[model samples]
Target: MRDSSSSSSKPVLTIGLCFLVALLEGLDLQATGIAAPHMAKAFALTPAMLGWVFSAGLLGLLPGAFIGGWLADRLGRKNILIVAVLLFGGFSLGTALADSYATLLVARLMTGLGLGAALPILIALASEAAPEQLRSTAVSITYCGVPLGGAIASIIGMAPLGEDWRVVFYVGGIAPIVIALVLVVWLKESQAFRAQTGEKIAGQGMLAQLFGPGHASRTLLLWVACFFTLTVLYMLLNWLPSLLIGQGFSRPQAGMVQILFNLGGAAGSFLTGRMMDKGHARRAVFIAYIGMLAALAGLGLSTSFAFMLVAGFVAGYCAIGGQLVLYALAPTLYSTQVRATGVGASVAIGRLGSMAGPLAAGQILAAGTGVGGLLLAASPGLVVAAVAARALLARRNRQPQ
Candidate 1:
């Protein structure tokens, strides 16, 4: 009794709600970075301490990705998604209330747990809600919200509305609470998720499917590619403004550059995601990796302010856009039976890279590895990701589709 023609149309409403959630995630993700200079002065934080705070937030993400997906499978996606939003909203409030370094750090960790859980679910929902032909485009449509949110954060951080860094956290916390209430009324469980019955059929376990015959190599290469690419992306995201500040720019000026970075991410997400819809996911990703490698090198080498902004934008386009491609590619690697696990595992592994990126960058900065030196060091990671993407393309071509 379903309208087949209706189903063929994209689920605009559903994707819009998911995009809203991602937009909030993007906002919260950059909140700490925007507030870093203020927080550093208030708490007397060294570069190493700031790095720990950044890494602490990401640390929760690794486990949350896996745990959230597992819970979504059993409790239903809507249920888990609602709770994740609530947790983030509540902790973002906590972040605003914190007066001490320790309190702020703890608040970030809690906020991140909610953030980590929400993203994979949103990505999965946006993707599965749409028809097959538009899959990657659907993913990108939802993912675009991230940079859009970051751009908003940049604007807010620089706006004369308030100099208090806590204002950003207040906005982050409150907006999601309102959004979660909206989701409670508006968001539905994914159709694909509902259609799946929790029957124990004869097959390998979820993790086994990832490494099983015909899948092990593809999964492994994707993991390596995801891990390295994320490392580079997070480094830029968590520290770009800080790096600019270190290079002697005012906070507002640095924030402007960061805004450019994310705007590029938004543009790239649309362009590359559309290309993937044409069955160019692998090629688009490989090219993005190469582009990011060049951009990272430029970021380190260029001293001109204009060139720095351009470099940040290009880097954001390539690396952040490339990450979204990985998100899109992950679920397709398995059948519906194994899709959640495959995507969850990939997210979990990628988040581990996220945690490591800020921490390592912190140590590097603390040790006097100048911004140029750090960026140069990071370029090789994109090379590895590019190679892995190319290998995955070849391997998939060889497989019997």
Candidate 2:
């Protein structure tokens, strides 16, 4: 095991690798959503069927997170992450040739297992290697990969083949294989993790430790936050393009709007990381959520393409921006012994929200509620999340500074 405590060569390389892994995590999330419309027509999918495609991957994620967390503690982060990348990358390539809706569904589920494992393990490794003064910033910077990946997926979805979303999937899937190969040659195990593993962590079970008394409250809150955030974020990400197309934008135009949304998210993520580094974690999250609420409301009322694009950017900014807080916050909430467990639990819970987002949006669209109506319906979740962030911040402030 290698400890990255000093300002040295391996720590820098490890952080860079963590950044790449983080990007892949977000890219996988955006793939299904950005390509949803094309996928729907290809399979002649009903709204419910499309919803299932989104949820299937999320379902796999729950178990993946749990198992990956436990494995990180037992076998170390490097090995588990390499396996996850290969698993997801291989499954994503398999999706390119999926002949039936059922086959596609299964591939997504398998991909979710791999994708789910990547985040926590990466976060755990980055935190271990980062210097204390820069830890939060590094964690948040690594998290920027999600929005950047999502943005890339949107850009790729706009390719000449138009609605043949399979191309995007193939590219995303293959990337992890490349990453895994590189990691095998370049990376090493974390020294802090290695030192602790032989002692208390040796016989610990993740499930038991995650639910243990001292950690119970923080664990519950982490899950609640993740669930709400994912539900809102994924619902919008998965359905927004189709919703725009329904409003009369062509598929290409709709994808373009999705690109703008990702662009805003990417910008927001970069700024959030910088601000969190400068000690504005709570303010940054609160303001971002406020912007999200406004963007959603504006989206419900606007019909102009320009307005929609602007609204999409703002909405994405707030929606995706909060991830910075989650990435930096989750690891710190628990001790090193359960760091992976905490991150895995938060992500697993969040997947529940992610699964619900597409389902609820699908039902609304199928029922003729329209995109604006659907967005308005979803706004309350953001409001509640804002309130929760405030409460959490106040509590943290009250704790001795």
Candidate 3:
């Protein structure tokens, strides 16, 4: 395995490639959501049917994260990531070709598998390459690619991409294939990871090591935090556009609001990531969650288009932004040997919440709950996550530094 530690060249290249990977993840994952309304029309889907379309993909992510991260620990980050990129990209292209709801469901599940596998490896590689002092900032900077991709998806949806929606997947599918080729040539295994040897890592399963003695409490809290934060974040990602359309915004206007939300998310990730590097990881994230809670409450009360856009931006800033910080922070909880596993497990657990978000929202919507009511319902999750972040910070503070 080649190590990037000796020169900035490898680390920089690794982060850059991983960033592109994150962008692809966002684009492909959000595709179904972005295409949902049109897809519903084409397939004559009920609200419940559409919700399952949103969920099948997320549910697939669970196993992918667990299995992919486990493999990365033994096989190497570069190896698993390449496979993942190819897997999702190809499946996404297949999704573009689907004619029926069942076909679309299966294709999204396959795409989700590939999508899920790549993420933990990407986080692990970025963390491994970043210096200890700047890890949070570096990973968050890299993580910004996610929202950037989401914004791009919103752009495509708003554009005359046509009601077919297949064109969106075509574009998303192609980008990752190109990126996977680039990774093969430029991305290498982490230096710290390289020194450790697979023999040592193979001695214990990544999942077992993740929950092993000293890591238990933090792991549980991290899982809890991830569950609630991602619940709100993904609920928005998968359903916000539809929610807005229901509120009477034009399709383009809804698309634009989603764009603003993701762009705000990118900005939030950039700023708070740096804050985490400056000894405010806990407070910064806690504050971000608090911001999200307030924004969600405001959203529940507001009916104006302008106010909704502003609230969407603020909510994305806190929820999606703080989620990226969680990605950066997860690896810190474990040793190099299990870092990928830790990140992967957090993501896998988080996907449970992600999987439920759209379905839960769908039920509410179907039951005659307005978008405001749904937003209000979502607020408690953010509040719980906010409390958890404060607890996590206090716990870490009392123990050592």
> How many clashes show up in model 1?
0
Q: Tens-digit lDDT track for model 2 on 1-401?
A: 24544437777888889889877777887788877877888889999888889888888888888788768877889999999999988998877778899999999999989988887898888888888777776776677777788888888877765556788888888898999999999887887788787665534455455666555555676676667777788888888877787888877787777888887887777787678778887889877888887888777777888888898888888888876667677777666777787788787878888888888888888898887789888878877766666565555555421
lDDT of 1 by residue, 334-380 (tens): 76655665676778888888888888999998999799888888877
What C-alpha lDDT, on a 0 to 100 scale, does residue 65 get in candidate 2?
A: 84
List model 3 lDDT by residue over 10-51, tens digit each.
778888888899998988877888998888888899998999
lDDT of 2 at 150: 84
- The best candidate by lDDT is 3
Regions more than 4 Å wrong, model 1: 1-10, 160-163, 200-204
Rank by lDDT, highest first.
Answer: 3, 1, 2
What does the lDDT come to for candidate 1? Answer: 0.84
Clash statistics: count for each candidate: 0, 3, 0
Candidate 3 error regions (>4 Å) = 1-6, 202-208
Which residue pairs in candidate 3 have backbone atoms (N, alpha carbon, C) closer than 3 angstroms, thus clashing? none
Give the alpha-carbon lDDT of every model: 0.84, 0.79, 0.85
